[model samples]
Target: MNSASSIQESRDEIVPSGPLIRLSLWVGDRNLPFWVLSIGMIVMLLWAGAFKMTKPGAEGIIPLVSNSPLISWQFKLLGPYMGSNMIGATEWTAALLFIVGYARPKAGLIGALITTIMFFITSTMLVSTPDATIAWKGFRYMNNLGLFLFKDVISLGVSLYFISYYGRRVMLDEARTDS
Candidate 1:
């Protein structure tokens, strides 16, 4: 081959090879929207975390952090502020990792899974029902948390989308590599 052709071949050889790379190239790069969504979650969660730090006056509509009978006062036994602080930090970290696209796929899906589980616990405390949140429709106290639950559902859906798209590509790449 000519020198020019040889140089082109070497450059091509340096390019990434895998289903993830191919899928990324084919998607026309819409990951920016994912980053936005992920960051927005982080900001809100951090605000919640800060509220937890303040204690007795966390600024939020839901009084769940302060007055929910569902979450025991025993969380106070762990230095009085550990529960809410840890929860907030976890949320912030998950969302931050996702926004930066550092393990974006795993972050999205696993983050949602964690949140979904938290919400399920919250719903259970409120209604004493199983994981089926919709089953807790009658009590006024439980109903008050509806908005929070609804938003979590949305988060779950978006996270699922991230998992479905990027996660599948990652898996595909791994599978191809193994073969």
Candidate 2:
């Protein structure tokens, strides 16, 4: 018991219990937010997957192009692959794995990497295409609507935050214990 207390004292000496501890936990350290965000992303990805599996219509994330008077030629290169459902399915697999919190350090990195790519690709499309011109104007997005966009933004942020958190010894211990 004395040794344990000594260890605790040593730990306290380094971390110093206070708002910093809580803040770290909330943002990227040993907090539940990281897991919550990960699982949330997974659930949303699944929801999107279900949407694709169910009501696949012209008004979909990708099919919305038909509603407009003119479709861009640039999107042709993307074709069906750029469709909302297709992209959701691709991301769902990764997000689901991440949501479960297995190999979180690695999972965090993967989620961040994929979300980063998604952010860049979507932003680029929104900027280059006339249809998505609204997104270029400012904080606003293009014609694309729904929680999917919101989820992507959150995932991108959480993934980045978690990656930093995963660096801490606390995360390493968690990963090691789980393994």
Candidate 3:
């Protein structure tokens, strides 16, 4: 084969063209990532909310709850068990909103807002909780607690995405109705 033909063949190989490419394009074009994030958040929120309602789960989060300035009031007002239950109830409500948001953007926007607040509070635990970090070699490293709290940062971002996505969708929908 001539160099020109070989180059053309190389170019064709370099340019992705197949079922995988088509599938990726389709997934990207549609809002598959957003849906996946939403579904995953819903499942996690449901599971975590259920767990928080349990004795062990409520007991386990004592340190974080007691330490957090944002939510410590709950513990003071309701005590540990009841306070945890209240948080669990909030999570369940947010999860339910997320489920309904699939059909209603306004609902999803509210859910996302709630989730954002939740994550923002939890993420602050990295700084508020003493055991969250360990000083190693004169540098601070995240311990298990810190690492766990750190995941909330990513969750916060996801919630933010949900906020923007749903917010824009709601506005567009309203605009269309008005028009």
Top-TM-score structure, candidate number: 3
Off by over 4 Å in 2: 1-30, 55-58, 63-85, 100-104, 123-151, 166-179
- What is the per-residue lDDT of model 2 for residues 7-93, given as tens digits with 9 covering 90 to 100? 767866785479977677457545577567666766766776666544463135453343322433323545543554456665676
lDDT of 1 at 21: 87
Q: Give each model a TM-score.
A: 0.52, 0.53, 0.85
Model 1 lDDT at residue 53? 62
- Whole-model lDDT values for every prediction: 0.56, 0.54, 0.91
Which lDDT tens digits does candidate 1 get at residues 1-179?
A: 66657976885786768989877755534676666666676676666656666665233322443344555453645544566666666666655655554554555556655555555555444343223234435744424355555565566566556556556656756767799
Which candidate achieves the best lDDT against the true structure?
3
lDDT of 3 by residue, 54-168 (tens): 9999999999989999989989999999988988999999999999998899999999999999999998988898889999999989999889999999999999999999998
Which residues of candidate 1, in runs, are more than 4 Å off?
1-36, 56-80, 100-104, 123-149
Candidate 3, which ten residues in sequence have the lowest lDDT sum?
A: 7-16
Instruction: Report residue 111 deviation for candidate 2 (angstroms).
Output: 3.2
Against the true structure, candidate 2 reaches a TM-score of 0.53
